[model samples]
Target: MCAASLPDTATFPFETAVVAGVGLIGGSVALGLRQRLLARRVIGYDANPEVLREAQALGVVDEIRTSPGEWLRAADLVVLASPMRTLSPLARDLAPFLSPAALVTDVGSVKSGITAEMEALGVRQFVAGHPMAGSERGGVTHARAALLENAVWVLTPGDHTPLTALSRARTLVEALGAAPVVMPPDAHDALVATISHLPYLASLALTHMVARDERLSLLAAGGFRDLTRVASGDPRMSRDMVVENKAALRGALARFRRQLERLEADLDDPEELLAAAAEGKRTRDSLPVVKRSLLPPKHDLVVAVPDQPNQIGAVTQALGASGVNIKDIEVLAIREEGGALRLGLESPEEVSRAAEILRAEGFEVRGRG
Candidate 1:
């Protein structure tokens, strides 16, 4: 799939690029590099030969290797996209083969430990990176180059990291349609601990709490499903992330506990509770809207569809035929007989076009701009 467009004058910077893992994130990195013409050649390495084979067959890479070898000597850019736990050992394994001038980066969620270890290993050009984008689904088969489009990609370079290397890293991130954010490794870990790790733990705990009774589970609604979605992610990866960043996560947990304690103490004070709820709503509403590069903010079109087979397909196919691309979507409500789908479109014009097309096809369309 195509990513958000880059400028016409964008240059291909690397002669050869290597992705050390051919999983979802790695495959996406390879595809993005190839699709954007950022690398003249994309090479892939994975511990799993089957994955490498799949990635090659899927055209995610120009060539595949089961292990690091002299092949890496040609790489000017290398992405460590393996699981967090494997990064350290993987770095050491590939270090001997890496070129002295190659720019190294990783997609590990937790950064402090990996960055320190990579630096200790004498990786002179290391740039710690984490893309704030992924899916619950895993594997190269589900990978999409556009997954990183408009996503925030954090880069954490150590104090000794070379400026040239960091600049190339930022260029790579931007060329792939991601926004590059620079921050220290420790700060990155601390922030993600609160925003990312803590949420996964909460989702897990909530899921376990609600799953104890079959009766209660049957009654669970959309809110419960949405809140607990992270619990359904790859559990092993989640476990590694929480455990790896336990210190910061514990800090986040304590802060959350304090908030909960305060809410409990305010149980008899409706006014205080109302004030807290209002502040939360206000803060959430004030968050920035997603923009496609320099384009205007996206708009939504909610379409009502019947439970009849292929209804969802019909709506999307109609829009596809009209060249309307849905930026995002959510099923607002569903029942045995029908459901409401909220489709996020690229522009107000697309919303209007989609609304007209769906209405002509007899679907109930709402929320058009």
Candidate 2:
């Protein structure tokens, strides 16, 4: 970011950093603090003494506190990585110790409950967030500084949340090499149910069904292994997620069942089944493996170009020379003389810069954000 674009309040150099749970997400946050030099001092708090000692020894934190009361007042930024069940009461308990200006955030998957707690506190300094990155493992032993790199960390800020607090959350997320995505709590919960939570349940069911049939296990292939990997995640955590997000999970499961029924019906028709698989392949192939947003959401811009070779190369070279990274690009249409190229970029700044470069090169550019 340019100097003019920088916020008046500096984003880094947090006076004190506190990780409340000191487990996977919390330990990773502490490691990120040290790695980025974002905090002058780091402290960790966990209910388990062994986890705390292990985390400190791993250099995840500069110090380990027996309790939040010992360190909360001094913390300029606090990350609560505890179980969702404990968040509401914990936040209320920590409220007395936190500074008026201190920023509070969490890594909870289910957002609506904790976000409601933050709202109940009547404090604008709270920002609700959930990082879309994790392994089948849990605990600080699995935590690393690079855990969040290139991950999509969703920031669910309610209308009552202060812009400054939300921006502070974003800065911290970016510093950890994760992209910050703004979303509402209900929307985030619903989306995750479809893409994350429900999938875990599906994987678990598939794994159980195959295990019950000894013959099926012997015939399991790479596809089965890959699809069932998420079922290996911490059972206790998965149970909590299922119970907490039951409303959304039920809806997602219903949709999944409907799709499955359609597929089962198509099994009798070879042509229909083949068509469905072909369409699915095309859709899946077009999706990026990992969404690594450096600064902005990917926006598509359609530009008219001649139906000629080297035209796409010229546009890419122009944008690349101007320091604008194109996230994705595709040829849309071809007329007798020209065609349209759709270029994907991060922000309006890139769109403006890219369009200037393209127009200078005698190509018609169009932008939509």
Count clashes in each candidate, considering only residues at least 3 apart in sequence or on different chains: 0, 0
RMSD to native, candidate 2: 10.2
lDDT of 1 by residue, 1-369 (tens): 322244545556887899999898999999999888888778899999999999988889988888778889999999999988899999999999989999999999998898889878998989999998787678999888888888889999888888998898999999999999999988999999988899999998899997779987997777788778888877788899999999889999999899999999878898999999899889964554454333334488899888788988999999999999987776774432237887888778889999999999999999655
RMSD of each: 5.1, 10.2
lDDT of 2 by residue, 48-145 (tens): 88888998787788888776574588888989888877877778877778887888999999888888887787656999999877765778989887
Candidate 2 error regions (>4 Å): 1-12, 267-272, 291-369
The best candidate in terms of TM-score:
1
The residue pairs in collision within model 2 are none
Model 1 steric clash pairs: none
Q: What is the alpha-carbon lDDT for the whole of candidate 1?
A: 0.86
Q: Could you tell me the lDDT of residue 316 within candidate 2?
A: 91
